[model samples]
Target: PDFSHRLAEYAAALSTRLVDLRRTLAEQRPDTYLPDLATSLNNQSVRLAALGQTEQALQAITEAVDLYRTLAEQRPDTYLPDLATSLNNQ
Candidate 1:
């Protein structure tokens, strides 16, 4: 149970970091970091889900889905499945 609690805590921290990363992405003048932040956010979402923090996972992944869907519309081959997976997790 300690491990589960620790995992939840870790997930919470990761979720917070993802939120910070999103903010950083928006605030950055250069767009080069956006994709990396998006990818990191996606990974954090998956980790939260794996930790059973479903609500946090859903929120993070929903953001990811939005990002991926936008990208997918521009280039389906690249981001469509990423979008689908995020949506499927819902």
Candidate 2:
């Protein structure tokens, strides 16, 4: 088995799941899931970017950044660093 390719496939699937989780958040149900999803998406985006899927990686990172930014606005001290990190990554 080609381990690298398999890893990319796994990262792609994780990105898709992150998108789904973001959509769920958009349905007006803001809860614990949003932050976790954003974190997961951010990590997956890094993997995808490393794997050469720049477009998808940016999309995922953008969404994660947005999510984190919103949370940061309500709690700057806690989430600002995370949002800054995401922005730096992009």
Candidate 3:
């Protein structure tokens, strides 16, 4: 249980960092790292869910799915798989 709790905490912290990085990259690079941010968030969500942080995990995955949806709209071949994966997680 302690290990699970620690893992959840770490996942939450990493999610926060990913959000900050996404915002910074968006401002500095403008459309260059959005996919990376989305992927990181998706992975973080899985980690969060594994440790029972359902609400936070859901929020993270939802954001990832939204990002993937937008990206897929522009290039389905590249981002549709991500969208599908996030949707499955949701």
Instruction: Name the best candidate (by TM-score).
Output: 3
| Candidate 3 residue pairs that clash | none
Model 2: colliding residue pairs: none
What are the lDDT figures for the candidates, one per model?
A: 0.71, 0.81, 0.85
lDDT of 2 by residue, 1-90 (tens): 499888878877876786677768755667656777777778878888877889988988998899899999988998899999888887
* Of 1 and 2, the candidate ranking higher by TM-score: 2
Q: What range of 10 consecutive residues in model 3 has the weakest lDDT sum?
A: 22-31
Query: How many collisions between residues are there in candidate 1?
Result: 0
lDDT of 3 at 33: 85
The stretch of ten residues in a row with the least summed lDDT in candidate 1 is: 29-38
Query: When superposed on Cα atoms, how far off is each prediction in RMSD?
Result: 2.8, 2.3, 1.9
- In order of TM-score, best first, we have 3, 2, 1
Name the top lDDT candidate: 3
lDDT (tens digit, per residue) of candidate 3 on 8-66: 78867877787778868866875898898888889888887887789988988998999
lDDT of 1 by residue, 1-90 (tens): 698778777876866776687768756732555455556667777777777778877787777777777777877997778777767765
